[model samples]
Target: MLYDEFNSYKNFVGADVFKNKATEKTDILKNLNPAFPVREYQKEALGRFYYYVEEYHQKQKPIHLMFNMATGSGKTLIMVANLLYFYQKGYRNFIFLLALATLSKIEGGGQI
Candidate 1:
C-alpha cells in the first residue's frame, strides 16, 4: 500500500522531472555572466570543471570537487565567482569554512 502510494506520487511528478529541472537550471546558469569577468585561463578551468560535473552526473556518480591552487593565485576570487554563479542558478544555502588566518584577513577586508 505504501509502495503504491509512493508510485502514485512519482507518477504525478514524473520520473524525468528532476533531470528537467537540472537541465533548466544549467541552461539559465550558462546564460549568466558573472560579476567578475573571467580571464581566459579561468574560463578554461571553469569549462573543465563543468565538463567533469556533467560527466559525473551522466555516470550516476556523486560529484566531488577540490580546487587545489597556489597561494596568491586568486583562489578566493575563483571560489566567490563560482559561488555567485551557483547562487544565480538556484542554489541558496552556503557554508564557507575558512582557516583562522583567512577568516581574519577576510574580516579585515584584505581578501574576499
Candidate 2:
C-alpha cells in the first residue's frame, strides 16, 4: 500500500523525517489566525511533506503525495502549510480537492 511504501522510505531516513519543520518557517505560521492553532500532528505532516519534497527535488523526480488522515484530523491546516511553503519556494498557483461534506463542515464552522 501507499502508506507502507512511505513508511519504508521514512524508516530509511530515520526518525528525523518526523521532526516539525513547519514551525521553523515562522513567516508562514506566524501569519495564521490566532483562533486556529496548528496541532503537533499537523506540524509532523508538514515536516514529512517537506522531507519528501526535498528528497524528490534532489533526485529530479516528480513530486506527488497524499496525506491520509481521519475525518476532522486537520488535513486542511496541512494544506495551508503546504501552500505557504510552495509560495515561499516561488510557486504561484494551487488547487485543492475537498469533499462536499468537508466543505459544509468548514462553512458550518465545524472542526476541519
Candidate 3:
C-alpha cells in the first residue's frame, strides 16, 4: 500500500518530477568521494529522497523519509552522500543515530 501510494503520486506527476535538481556545486555525485563510487540504484534512492523533500516543502508538510534497503545494500553509502548534499546546501549540523542492535553486533565481532 505504501509503495502503491508512492507510485501513484509519482505517476500522477510524471516520473521526471523525481529527477535530481541540484547544480554541480550541490550535486550528490559530484560531491561524493572518488574512492566511493555510488551504484545506479543508490543514486536513484537519493533522487527519490530529494524529490520528496521538495514535495514536502511545496505542501507545507514536515520532511520525513526512510531508506528501506536490505542489509549490505549500501545504506551507509547513501547516508554519507546525503550528508555531503546537505553540507553543500549550507547545512553545518547533523545528528546520526545507529541502532543498538547494530552496535552490539559489531561489538560481538559480527559482520554488520
Candidate 4:
C-alpha cells in the first residue's frame, strides 16, 4: 500500500486506535490478553517506525525496516503488532516472506 493511501485510511478510520491507551486506567488490556504487555519503549519505537514507513510510502520510496531484537525479546509480538497496525490502517492482503530456514524453524517448533 502506498503511503498517502495508508495515511488517508488512517485518518478516515481514526488515529486514536493506533495510540496506546493501555497506560490509562482501564480493564481493556486485561480482557484482550495481549501476547505480551507493551513496554513504553516498545510503544515509542513502534510509533516512530510506523511514521517512517508511512512517510516512505507517501514518497513512493522502497520500504525496508529491520528490528534488531534479542532472542528472548518479543520479536514475534512486535511483528504481530505491526501487522495489526497495518490492518487497522486498511490493509487486507498480507504476504509474509520468510527464508527457507526460518520456515523450517517454525515448522519444527510446531512439531516439538
Candidate 5:
C-alpha cells in the first residue's frame, strides 16, 4: 500500500523511525548561548514556525518559512537560532538576504 511505500523511506533511529515521531518540545531557548529574555509573543511565533518546518520535512516536501515580526521583536536572534538548529541537524548550506531600496545595493558580502 501507499503507506508501506512511504514508511520504507523514513529514517530509523533506535527502532523508532524519524518519520513516525513528532518533533519534541525542544529546549532550543536554553541551549542558546548569551540567551536573552524571550517574550510570550516570540515563543508562540517561533513555535508555530518550527512546527510547520518539521511537518514539511516529515512529509518529504520542500519547505519555505516566513516570519512576520514587528521591528525589534528579536527577528535576528530567532533566525540565527533556527539556522543553528538546522545546522546541528546536518544542514550546511544557507543564504541570508537583506532588502534595500533598490537593486543597486545587492552585492556579495565580501564587498563593502
Candidate 6:
C-alpha cells in the first residue's frame, strides 16, 4: 500500500468489483487537497483498513482494527481517511472514535 502504488482487490471480491476505487478515491482526495498533507503512515494504515474491509465482506465475519498514536498524532486524520475510504465502498453510518473509560478520560472528552 504505497502512495504511488496501486492495490488490486481481485482476490476476495470479483476481479473488477472495486477496480481500484479506493486508490481512485485517495488520488482524488490528494488532488483536491494537495496541501492538506497526508503522511505516509496514514496512507498505509488506511490501505490496510480497506483491505480488512474486503476481508470482512468476503468472510462474513467481524474484523477489529485499531489505530494508536500519541495525542495530536494526526489520528483524527487517519480516522477520517478510514471513514472516507469505507464510504466509497458503500458503507454508511460509520461508528468512530470510541474508547474505554480511562482512554476516554485521557482525551478529556470525545466529541464529533
Highest TM-score against the true fold, candidate:
2
Give lDDT tens digits, candidate 3, residues 1-112.
4456657876898764444432322466766666556766676677677656554444334555679999867786688777887786899999877664663554334322
TM-score (C-alpha, index-matched) for candidate 2:
0.71
lDDT of 2 by residue, 38-73 (tens): 888777787777766765444334666778899878
lDDT of 1 by residue, 33-70 (tens): 44344454454345445444554244334545666667
Which segments of candidate 6 are over 4 A away from where they belong? 1-28, 31-35, 55-60, 98-112
Number of the top-ranking candidate, with lDDT as the measure: 2
Query: What is the C-alpha lDDT profile of model 5 across 1-112, one tens digit per residue?
Result: 3234334534222323331232243556666544355555565555555545655345435765567788667666577667767887899999967543432332443222
Instruction: State in Å the error of residue 65, model 3.
Output: 1.8
Question: Please, what is the TM-score per model?
Answer: 0.50, 0.71, 0.63, 0.49, 0.53, 0.50
lDDT of 2: 0.71
Candidate 4 residue 63 C-alpha distance from true site, Å: 1.2
Model 4 lDDT tens row, 22-95: 23313322332353576665554465466566543444346666776666465554565666666768889987
Candidate 6 per-residue lDDT over residues 55-109, each given as its tens digit: 4344334655567667756676567666666676788998764554543543335
Give lDDT: candidate 4, residue 103.
34
CA displacement after TM-score superposition, residue 19 of candidate 6 (Å)? 18
Q: Could you tell me which 10 consecutive residues in candidate 5 have the lowest summed lDDT?
A: 13-22
The alpha-carbon deviation from the true structure for residue 70 of candidate 6, after best TM-score superposition, in angstroms, is 2.1
What range of 10 consecutive residues in model 4 has the weakest lDDT sum? 21-30
TM-score of model 1 relative to the true fold?
Answer: 0.50
Number of backbone-clashing residue pairs for each candidate, in the order shown: 0, 0, 0, 2, 0, 0
